[model samples]
Target: MDQRKYNIYFHTHTISGIIIAALLYVIFFAGSFAFFKDSISAWQKAETHAKIIHADYNYLIDSLSKTTNLQGRDFDFYLLNSRQGAYINMSASKDTTISKPAAIKSKSKRRGQGDGAYFLYFFANKQPTTYAEGYDMGEFLYRLHFLAPLNQIPIRLGAPFGYLLAGIVSFLFLFALITGLLLHWDKIKANFFLFRPWSKWKTVWTDMHTVLGVIGFPFQLIFAVTGVILITNFALTTPFSHFLYDGKQEQLFEDLQYNRTIEVPYSYTSLDKDFDLNAFVSKWEQQWQGSPISRIHIRNFKDQNMQVVLEAKPNPSQRFAGSGFVKQNIATGEVLASKSPVEDANYVDGVRSLIYHLHFGDFGGTALRLVFFVLGLMGCAVIISGIMIWLVARNKNNIPLYKRRFNFWASNVFLSACLAMLPVTAFTFIMLKVLPEINQAAIYRVYFYSWLILSIYLIALRNPSKVNLHTLLLSGIFCLFVPLVNGFTTGLWWWKTWSSEANGIFLIDTIFLLLGAASIMAFWKVRKQAKSFQVLLGK
Candidate 1:
């Protein structure tokens, strides 16, 4: 084999580097802060911010049931206790109603309320859930870290983009780590902290990138592979599931089957004539004595013989199943199915479920999630720094004008977004709570549009002036004051919530303050450096 055949990899390597570097920065920065999502959410909830009092699950449910006529209705209710965020949401819908049957009689079902119910249904039932053309806050930022506006493409196209980015980035990161190790092998002994201020600008940049890359290599590699596996499972595992299982993915779901019963056809009719919700909730409470039932789903809402699904409250450690569904026959009030294993599932299902939990940090506590979040941020940083190094190295040579311009524009625009986007997104989160008119979908759309528009504008602009640095500073300042904004707008603040178990609000406030302070410092540093450069050149 020709040795230069290795050069073929670099063609894609360069592209991956350009794409991933920009993407990873946004991923790292936003993701790092997202570690405190629960805490931040706690900071925004009015009732939750008052104290660490655990709501009486049983009392709350009974009270909610009394307040809302749940009998003979097609809907379910979920009450989360000690969840560290937001007020009580007693969701009632066809699948969420405990006294009704599922509306969708076929293989697929859609939720009319929170996404958590469908998530529980899929995980508990051990069936795959499909995604539509929308975005979650985390997923949106992650996609921007790579695809950005290219996400307007359909699922078929977007999934491949995810896989390709992951596959190529993993390889390039692996190579860069190996090559960097080899290149630095000589100086490894003497120059661990080698930073030569007297060296040329490019030299300093390369050294900063390479040295940090070397230190963070292990983190980079783990994040690269895990992130790929985590994000593009639809791409990577779907093909494998088809190939290995002959496209019968049901076998893979066998592990998740807990008291799954056969689906039987039933006639459709509204049975909202008469039923006692108070007594029904009483019976449910008696059955799941130790288990706190969080959600109630009424399947086949229009059908008289619909089944009611009462989901168990989540236990922090092993609460991977979004919620447990206990199906009951509406006519007879007899329990039909639940998420407990009636029969043992195969190893594949176990592995698959475990993988999902691992990727999402669902199986872990706050500490584990924090670790995952930090590692993710480090991965983003590695991508940013690595790309910066590549650019600096190339710029040192007599590169062509078009290539130079492209690199300059890509570097500045992408880096600025990556650096500034997190703070901007943080503001959006606060806006979600503060602005009553703003719903979840609206919050996400506005956030996405704002980021996209700003990034495009930055890319079009040729020069970075004081205005650019000021924008960065403003983004951070807004993020830092988000907690205060929440307090003023919604009467929820960190200090007010400190006495309660919702102290996650305090953590959120501190994190924002730290991140905002860091951003402000960085802004001033850049401005000072620009001034020094101008003075030296007599500009």
Candidate 2:
């Protein structure tokens, strides 16, 4: 093997590495929080127990009939009556003679304030493709951070760019892991927790990154490759589908366990005078005792041959079970199919589902998710420390003062943007309630542009050491106050959540505290260092 090629394999281009580092940091960090998107919603919208029990779809139909004309039309009633969560919501089409299903309402709001409007506003402007609507905000942000909304590049172009990044980063991360392990292989028994600050700064950062990278490399590799696989659907899956199946897309879809939900045509004139939703519920509940149906989807609502899908939340361990899915004929109320992962199936379908589970950290219980969360936070730390080490290495060399210091502090400003963006995102979510009509899409645009402007201004401002320290402190204070403001505005807090054990909110609050305190301490150290540098300059 060629030594130069090996170096090329091991060390990525500087610009690419930095961009990948920033993107990966965002994905890992936000994804860790995104893991608990549901919990955040529950906390933000605490539901008071309403006197009325969950009414059946019959009641829903009746309500729509009484409220407005829903006769002789197609619509999907998302029977939240079956779901465990406190709210019930429905989507239906009007009697405008259109056969298509229209979203009547996405979600029911909790009293006082609600986050549904926020989520709705966020997705309204983005206009997600047919496939992307099922996923939540965190996943959307993860994709956006990688693809970065490049209008000049097509999906094919941007998707390849994304995969190339992951492929390259996975290779480098693997290199760092292997080499660091070789360097510390023998000393693992003696120096597992060694942190020698007195040594050269490179040694310190190298040791820190190495240790964390080595410990977390397995997750990093799996997550990076899986994320790449998830994003690059065509690049990874298309070749096999083409070469093996000879261009039969349906065969490929079957092989990959992708179900094509097609609507059957039927007469709209002869329809049942009354539909019984309670009867359907009774049959489903009797069959599956413990599982709760979360959603009931009716397709081709105006057509008499419509199908109904009842999705249930199974046991946590049943995530991969194909049997978890159930479908029924709406008119006849007959069970059509139920499949389980344990049964014999194509090997590829199993792989695809497992890949999704692993990427989302949904395979394991709370323990595994917590482990994933910790590693994700450590990944963020690695990016910050790596950038710091780069500047430190340059400064310690026999270089000019202006060049060395300018580069060092300029990098710090970018770091500020990366670290501070989380609180800014949280604030934006809160603002959705405070100002519902502000057009969230425009707000997001302003948020990102403002961050860039702030970062540039910080880099150009004089006395950068003091300014950098102040920026860090400002970030720390903002993060610390997030939960307090949430409580004041929403009337929910971690302490009060003890009775219900809202682990999601608890996790967010705890992580915010830890990050805020660490940031404050880091800023204090920088402040001390700035004073010492000024004293030396005075002499």
Candidate 3:
């Protein structure tokens, strides 16, 4: 490449990377942990996914029918991947003759005019709990990856601005990755072999950034593309929707197979036949043996015109496939439309599944997810080193003092914010065990407040190296306590879980054990340097 073009590539990459660095770090870090979200939930709840291979749908419906009137209503059951529980949703009865129940009504402002009940149902324990009671660190970190919590802000730009921001960051990150690859194109091969721990600060940072960035290029690039598409698909498709579907978003989504819309008009006639839902569900389960039923949507329940849509995902181990659903007429016992996941999946299913599985890293099971998590951590390392390089390159006497000061301050803030996440997350896991009766509000308070306090304190130190030191030490201590705390609270230690075949719960404990070990090792090395008053790590 010519000098001018090289300069352009370098500057563009630097600016774009810097612009999204901190936010991108949050996404990557939180997302890395989110790969184990299910395991984390299982671990924290002290439940074993292995024990619950199937949910008792019959018992679930029976339990729900006992509490609420099931006539002429819509019901949705969303099964968790863990198979241990599900989300039970009940909408207001479709029959206008039936009035809203006074027991369920509230003066809540954010609620819609129509009332609905959403709660969690544990299949294994046969118990119901509020959604708040089901909240866990896994869900929190997963939402954090896409900045979903930020949607709580009142600002609306025709859509959720939090997702908009995340999409923008992902797009910019893709741009930076492209420009960076181009900037390093000429020396790519040679750079692959470059590593010098003893080099000057700027050189060390540059080498670390280049090496890890190259190594993680494909994984990062996949996330960048898929993250943007997944988060902003609706927004991005609006213009195309106008052209293709005559401006109907619902039509476009249906056409693209993102969802299957069934508008079942009520006949307003009561059904005389007694339907055994358990026997009905059992028939389908037997038909679709290996595949798990993920969701069921019942419209106009117990009515003559009732319709049930059953959706299921194919078992990837049998054959990698997306999913398909069946729509059935309840009264006539007729199959309205069928798309068997085991036999025929539409092209849209293939495309959507690829994007979903690749982005979420759920296709290949635990081994693949662990590999992806390591790559995600490597992405974090690249981001941190890039920030270090940005600071060191500008920390010169020749640079204006104001610019130098601003650069240093920016680096301090970014490093503090990013590094603090390690210890804060570990701390949250420990707290998850220590706290009694954890819930959504409690988790938010514990995590965000702890993170805020630690970040503010680190920023006060005003040294990037010191931020790294403290975060490492704190991360080591807190992470080491995670499994220990869980054992103390739940009696499910590493040995016990593994021996009991509760691998999902064991996965989380093992992950924290490894992370705690690595952090402590790094902390020990850094502590030794501190004793000698060496600045090698600061380099």
Candidate 4:
């Protein structure tokens, strides 16, 4: 509360917030939608998660076996992102001396065709699709939350540049939040109830920034910490692994329960009995009824020493945080190791699950996720207001003209980048329905290119009021078109989807419609107040 401490806190907070305002806005805006990632994916494909049947792994494996010998190959089936399907990750056979399975050429540009590849197999359609083909706006926005697209940038920073940058921003965001809280510590209680939307721009932005920042502090704090932990695991864990585990990073990961290695020798002799994957999976599923099987790994394929590893995580609603792992020998039906997801939970499981659930809002279902999404958007509001406050605070006669100009330019660029995302995202969603192609490349091109064009245009305007108003107008139009085009293309209008009880698909249409309505309402209000809101700060 002292003057010296207050000034330090104020300066550090301002610097950090300004440094990360734009990127943090992207993270919040994209992450808010990511809360509905599954719903968005289901909506795009016109499929209901509740209605779609679970994957028919047996049929998929059988179909795959016909194409390539299933023997001696290692297989990993992941249901983490499965929607009426399973992910198949087939590895080359462990027995190098034996004849290998038929090589399936990878259709992706990332890697060459070898003895293996991975793809999603939809049981409803009875077909397979590569990850790129299966990519949807849900995945796009989810990955965009942490700037995954930035990974394509040719940069080396001793780690993935995108992830490393995201982590650094997250860490700095935490510092800013702490400093901001401290700076306002004396007036926190009084400011908690303050609002002055009709006041001068500076006071209005300052009040909004402080009030919302305080209100969303805990929520954003959780996100900041978990985000750093999630994105910077490489940077944070490396030193500890090097020291404690003697550079055996794998061992450190195993100890933390992040990964487990079940080693089984590849016996040359083939198994005499048939390996029934369905029966094996079904048996475990039945035994662990409430806990979902997260992953299944088969090593050595049909060889005598083949082992099947089943990893399960307790449903958040059921037990919150537990890991279940069972490794069993296929040839002899012998259980080599086992752990109960509900009963055998540990400290690591609790910490890991707590972080994931808190960050993701997965514990309380759709309603809680909606609350989280609203708070995320509120976080976006706080960042914008903070930036505006920074600009307005520097727009005084005492400030140097050049310094004021720099501040205004900084705010202009940051706001342009941040606000452009709203319309660009809605535009991309509309494109998803109308475009002929719907793959990763298509999504990337549409979203990024449109974003660039719109951002450049906004920056050219040089007027923050115009930039804000125009983005709102564009966002309103595009967001409204999202549900309309989706209805026309998929024949699943609001009423029809609601009647069918397809909650997942219905939720997507509903959210976009609401967003469109809100954007339009704000646009109308802003247009009426354009003259007053339009502050020529630098000028």
Candidate 5:
């Protein structure tokens, strides 16, 4: 390529990357952890430490039916494969129009606080128990990954702005991926495996960025495309409904079978007196064969015309967005309708399912999730290094001192955002371990305030880079102690957890230990770079 063309590509790449660097880092960092969301949730609740015993599903159902008057109510039954415990969640409202399921409400004095739902827990050979609240560290992190908003905006408008910004950044990310490949096309093969830690800082960063970007190119592309698709799906669906389906959204959904719901007429007589849940479960198992039923939703419980919807575990080979559903008559145990991606999905539906599976890394279990998590972090590193390279390039040019100072400060702000996330996340983990009963809403406040304080410190400091180094060092220390905190609070040490059935807790502790080691190494590398830069500048 000629110098003019090269310059144009270089400038385009740098400009586009800088525009969304901080946001990309935040998204990637949170998303990496989200791959282990369920494990995190289990770890948060210390579910493994709880006394668990095998319970007969039929016995639990029969007991609930006899003990509770569930007439004209909606309820959900959740069964976990890892433990013998089960949960039955009865919503507050009997109205079919109520979309949101009731959560166990907490009695914490904090305003707007509630436990997830009122749930009855069942175990073998023991009386059923109930809980008023549940922790949500995993769910919160998953939401923060996709729903994080700019701090400057009004809180009410944050969601819409955050979504819009995410869509825009994802689109730009796709563009960057294409342009990046084009710019590196000439030397791609030659530099595919190149790395030189002893080289100049900018050179090392450039090599690291290139190697990571190239190695994870396919993963990055999948994330970018799926991210845009997910964010813009509703926006595109609305227009397509209007133009293609005459504004009949239901018609569109029917065609896609995306939001299929089974509607049965209401009956005045109560059927709970004669309903045999064990028979229904047996029929469902017979139909689905090996698939485990995860959740069961009963609409208008006790009513003669009640409908039961059972969602079976997703087929590993199907690669769909959700588990298949079997809708049945609650009174007759008759199957009404069923849909499984493995059995009935059309080409378009299968493609949609594959897209979700690829994006979420759900198909290949823990090994694939681990791969996605590492690549996601590497994506963050790519963004951070790109910004650093841009800053270094600017400093090498003959720019005005004022402009240079502005760039320097801007780079510090960006670096601070990236580095602060580690400590903030570590602190949040520690807080959850130390105060397991803390209000769920308070968790978000802690995370937000910690990030805010660190950001303000970065902006106000005279030597931001030095502060960045110190913050990283502190983050390392915090991370290193997280396992100890968890052990102290839960009495489930890593060694014990490792031997127990709840390996998720053990895995989480190990991850923290490794992350702490990585953070310490990062601190050392940054400190060395700072010294090198100072000597170069004769400071």
Candidate 6:
């Protein structure tokens, strides 16, 4: 490329890098860990720490029926067997009769509302153990990736703003990735294996950034594109529904569901006390055979016009194929609408499923998730090093310190954000393990406050490099002690958990221990670099 074109590409890359570096770092860091959400959740919750054993569906149905009168009411039963242990979540709402259309609309609306009055029945021993509401550690970290940026905004605006910000950042990330490739097109092959750690700081950072970026290019692109699709879908759904669907959001939903429509109106009438849930289960089992039932949604329960929807477990081979639905008429035991299994899903349905699975890294199980996590951290490294290279280039070009004061401040904020993330996350884990009884709201408060306090302290220092070093040291200390803290508080020591039913907890503890050691090493390296720089400056 000519000088002018090269300069334009470089400028575009740098500008985009600076604009989204911090946000990208935050997203990648938190999201990488989200791959192990269920494991982390199990690790955090004492009730779910034991080895998981699948519960008998017959027993589950019978127990739920006896405990909670399952006739003519809105209720759901969700089954899962993962690192979090095999459990059934049963939820029921008070009886309310409405017209069929109204019931359908209400169901759609309630989808986004919180899961109400749910009980988790764990199948640890031969008998079932029940756990009510508790803090979900996995969900907290997962939400931080996409929702933390909007925490301070008002609820009405915050959600949209969060989705918009995620979408915009994803778009710019793709732009930056393309520009970076173009700028280095000629050197791409050579740079793929290049790493000059012993060279000048800027040169070293440039090489590291290039190598990591190229290595994780495919994963990064997948994440970026899927992220754009997911976030923008949520952000723009309302507007699109207004313009394209005649202001009916339900119509948009119908279009996405392959234009399938359920217009049957509910004719409300009291039902007999002997509602045959066993028959419903039997029909479902006959249809799906070996496939485990993941969720069961019953609308207008106990009423003659009740509708039951059963969702089968996701197929692992089909990345995008989620649970298939089988809707039934409760009054007659007749199948109303049966969506094809995910394995045989067609174009539209498959694409929708693929988007969700890819974005969430839910398809490949633990091995794939580990690959994603490592690549995600490398992506974080790419962003951080790209910013450092820019700052270093600015210093080398003799940019006036006064004129670049704002840039300097922004750089500090960026570094503060990047460096503080790990420490804040580690601290949150420690807090959750140590205070298992804490409320959900309070757990998040601890997370946001710890992060905010550290960030403010770093920014107040007015020295990005110094702040980075200090934060690294602090983060290292916090991380290094995480395993010990977990053991002390939970009494589920790593050595003891390995051979027990709590292997998930054991794995989590081991990861934390390794991370702590890495943090400490990073702290030492940063401190040495700082000392070397001070000597060079004759400080």
lDDT of all the models against the reference? 0.53, 0.55, 0.84, 0.86, 0.73, 0.69
Q: Regarding TM-score, does 2 or 3 come out ahead?
A: 3
> What lDDT score goes with residue 87 in model 2?
28
Q: What is the C-alpha lDDT profile of model 6 across 75-191, one tens digit per residue?
A: 556655452333333333334432211121121222222323334544453344333233477767777687554755654442566666777888899989888888888998777
**Cα-lDDT of candidate 2:** 0.55
Judged by lDDT relative to the true structure, which candidate is superior, 5 or 6?
Answer: 5
Clashing pairs in 4: none
Clashing pairs in 2: 91-104, 92-104, 322-339, 322-340, 322-341, 323-339, 323-340
- In the range 41-118, model 1's lDDT, one tens digit per residue, is 345444354433432334433543444433323444444343321122223333333454332222213453322222
Lowest summed lDDT window (length 10), candidate 4: 105-114
Q: Which ten residues in a row have the lowest lDDT in candidate 2?
A: 115-124
RMSD value for candidate 2: 7.2
True-structure lDDT of candidate 1: 0.53
Q: Encode model 2's per-residue lDDT on 431-450: one tens digit a residue.
A: 53354343325455545665
On a 0 to 1 TM-score scale, where does candidate 6 land against the true structure?
0.83
Q: What are the per-model numbers of colliding residue pairs?
A: 27, 7, 0, 0, 8, 9
lDDT tens digits, residue span 339-408, model 4: 9998888899999999899999998989999999999999999999999888878777798888888888
Provide the lDDT at 11 for model 3: 94
| Per-prediction TM-score to the true structure, in the order listed | 0.66, 0.72, 0.95, 0.97, 0.83, 0.83
lDDT of 5 by residue, 1-539 (tens): 99998888877777788888888888888889988887887788777744545446667656554644445666677775444455666644344443433333334322211222345464644454433244367766776677553433554332366777777788888877877877998999999999998888789889988999988899999999998888767666888999999999888876765554545555667775666666776777777765667777778777888988877755554434445678877677677888762465566666677677888887787889989999998998898788778778777446777777777778878988777888888888898877636544668678889989987786566354566677779789988988889899889899989887677788788889998998899998888765445311212
lDDT of 2 at 184: 52
Q: Candidate 6 local accuracy as lDDT?
A: 0.69
Candidate 1's error at 226, in angstroms? 3.1
